[model samples]
Target: MIGLILAIILFNFIAFKTNRRHTQNSILHIWLFTIAFQLIFDTMIEFKYHGYWYFDKEVDWLGLLAHTLLIPPVNMIFLNWYPLQGRLRSRILYTLIWVAAIMGYELLTLLPEPWGYFHYGWWNLWYAAILDPFLFYILIKFYRWIRSLEERI
Candidate 1:
């Protein structure tokens, strides 16, 4: 609980405060897209499949806090820092670094009780590792598409 709360505060602060690149509209779009995407993915994996869940195996309202507050800002921060103009190799490397950080954080969230909010049933870090790059790719593509739309508008 404490861990998740602190992380939410810190991540939101960093994401919003340090954002010099995206406009308010863009940020709003990104936030909405992230929440919707996460909810869809979690609904399938956490609920339908019972792969993993937040706080407990059963559905809980507290888990919504983790879903709504924690990850979108992290995604914001990620897109904010992404090297859009950099070489392909640099971009790939940057993504891998973020994946490692995410995996590390996921590990921390597997800790007991008050500190931990995440749990696994059949899912594991390896699954996340495989999925994250594709996820990041999707985010990048979405951001680019949004940017293109913004340019036309």
Candidate 2:
């Protein structure tokens, strides 16, 4: 868990530094959203398993923070590589593609033994299955709103 947190932080730092010129705020927002989701998910997992949860766990806190920071870079990379631009149709397509990619990553946690980062169980799996699509939709809408605001500015 510590290692994962460190890795995520390192990756986020690298991504942020590399992309500082083009879309820092957008990427930051993505990172914030990702982190927020992770926190909520983490809380749910802890409540289900441990019966209680606290951020006093240094490693868990670090992991959550790192995961949040890492999200922007990961999503930014996806968007840049795929180049989502132009019409509403294209935007929807791009958003779906991102949703698919996020789901793919989440599914990877299920392969073999449950990856320690994400608890692998029926409830967690179901939660993720439901959560990902909703989150993706919200994210897409948020992105659209941000874009519109940028245009107006």
Candidate 3:
């Protein structure tokens, strides 16, 4: 719980410091929408089907809180640093880097119960490593689409 709160605070602080452009509000909104969908999907998969579990069976709310707290700022930071003008190679590399980071984080969460925030039931690391890059790709594409749509308006 302490770790979760600290992470939220750190994420928010970084976002606050770096995400200053008024123009980015739209990007932030898009990120929020994407992360919200992720949370809902995760809830169904992790809770309903028991794909994974958090902490113990007792304080499951922290799992929800963790997802809600972490994702938006992560998306924001990813976009903030992403090279909007860069070539396909640079862009793909950037995406891969973030994907690696996410996979590493997931691996950390897979540690033993008291230290680790999460434990896999049916889920495993390889699935996360493979899917995370695709997920980030979807988010980047979605954000770009939203930008283009707003431009047309």
Candidate 4:
């Protein structure tokens, strides 16, 4: 659980410290959206199909910590630094870099019990590498939509 605790602290610290683009309202929206989105996906992958799970393969508070606190800040960091106005090549490259970093982080989460909090069933790093871009695409689209709504208000 130490790994999970450290990640929650570091990711949230960096997210709040480094973010300059989003307003307070937008950050709140993004935080809630990320948590809800992750819950939906996790319900299927972690519970239904048992693709993978955090801490354990059953519903627990530690897994909730991983879902709510650990990931949304990372999403915040991702959207905060995303090259929104970059050319297509740069945007794609940026996404690729984030994907690689996420994959590496996933590997770290798989280390062991006290240090590592992640577990695999039928899932693998390749699966994450393949799916992360699409997940990021959805997140970007959602953020764009949120911005559009905010602009009109």
Candidate 5:
């Protein structure tokens, strides 16, 4: 609880300090994709499939927020530094770094139950570790496609 809020505050502060939203349209597009992905995956894993669920000490809203609030800035950071036209090796390295970070964070949520927001039923860290790279690659490709369209206009 304390840790999660502090992390969010710290992340938002960095995002604010960096002024990463150079274009409102671009931010909106990224946020749309991020929120959509979070909601869909969260709903499936947490609610529908019962693979995992979130919990907070205070309220249910706080639980859902684990996905919504934390994910966009992460996606933004990933999209922002992504090598758009790099060589295959560079792209692979970049993807690996982001995926590793995502997996690391997800694993952190398993910190001794009460302080953590996530509880797994069938889902495991390995699933997250594997899926993160594919998810990031899709998002990066979507970002590039959007940028190309913007250039056309």
Candidate 6:
């Protein structure tokens, strides 16, 4: 968690310094996609672990919400920091990074003996494996849409 936070900060710093051409709309769209993805995935995990019932625990709920919101912004920061020149290259890099990060997180979760909020169930692993490609495709499509809109203006 600490490492993730630090990485986000560092990425943001570099992105802001270098990617001055990035528009607010681009950033917002990226953030929206990220938040939506996190919310969906986290909700699924929560349901699998804690059943259909929701919790009144403010801390847990807030933490989940906060992380969901943070996902896109952090992702945007990294993507902007290393802005890809071509669509194909961007999509490939995006897919690779997302997969790598998810795998690393899963590994960390498994390493500390049930230290993570979500367990390494077969379903969860399968979900994670499938989600990366889906997210990459969605992000690429969305990014192209945004670029087209920008060109029209």
- Candidate with the greatest TM-score versus the true structure: 4
Residues 34-117, model 3: lDDT tens digits = 678786777677767777767754436677777677777777788778888899999989988888888887777666655478
- Candidate 2: stretches off by over 4 Å: 1-22, 45-59, 79-100, 110-116, 124-127
Clashes of 6: 0
lDDT of 4 by residue, 32-136 (tens): 998999999999999999999988899999899988998889999999999888899998999999999999999999999798999999999999999999999
List the candidate numbers ranked by TM-score, top first: 4, 1, 5, 3, 6, 2
Candidate 5's residue-wise lDDT over 34-150, tens digit each? Answer: 888878877777777778777733337777566667777777777766777689899889988877877777777777655566678888888888888888878887877777777
**What TM-score would every model get versus the actual structure?**
0.97, 0.57, 0.83, 0.98, 0.86, 0.62
Whole-structure CA lDDT of model 4: 0.93
| Candidate 4, RMSD to the unseen true structure | 0.7
Model 2 TM-score on a 0 to 1 scale? 0.57
Q: What is the C-alpha RMSD of each candidate to the true structure, in Å?
A: 0.8, 5.0, 2.4, 0.7, 2.6, 4.8
Q: lDDT tens digits, residues 1-153, model 2?
A: 543455466666766565633365566666677667666766666555543222333346544554565565665554444444568687667766766766676554434432334444335445555666576666656766666676687
Candidate 1 residue pairs in backbone clash: none
Question: Where in model 4 is the C-alpha error above 4 Å?
Answer: none
Output the worst ten-in-a-row residue range by lDDT, candidate 4: 22-31
Error of 5 at 76 (Å): 0.4
4 versus 6: better TM-score goes to: 4
lDDT of all predictions, in order shown?
Answer: 0.93, 0.56, 0.74, 0.93, 0.74, 0.58
lDDT of 1: 0.93
Better of 2 and 3 by lDDT: 3
Candidates 1 and 2, the one with greater TM-score: 1
Whole-structure CA lDDT of model 3? 0.74
TM-score of 4: 0.98
**Model 5 Cα displacement at 140 (Å)?**
0.8
Candidate 6: residue 150 lDDT (0-100): 92
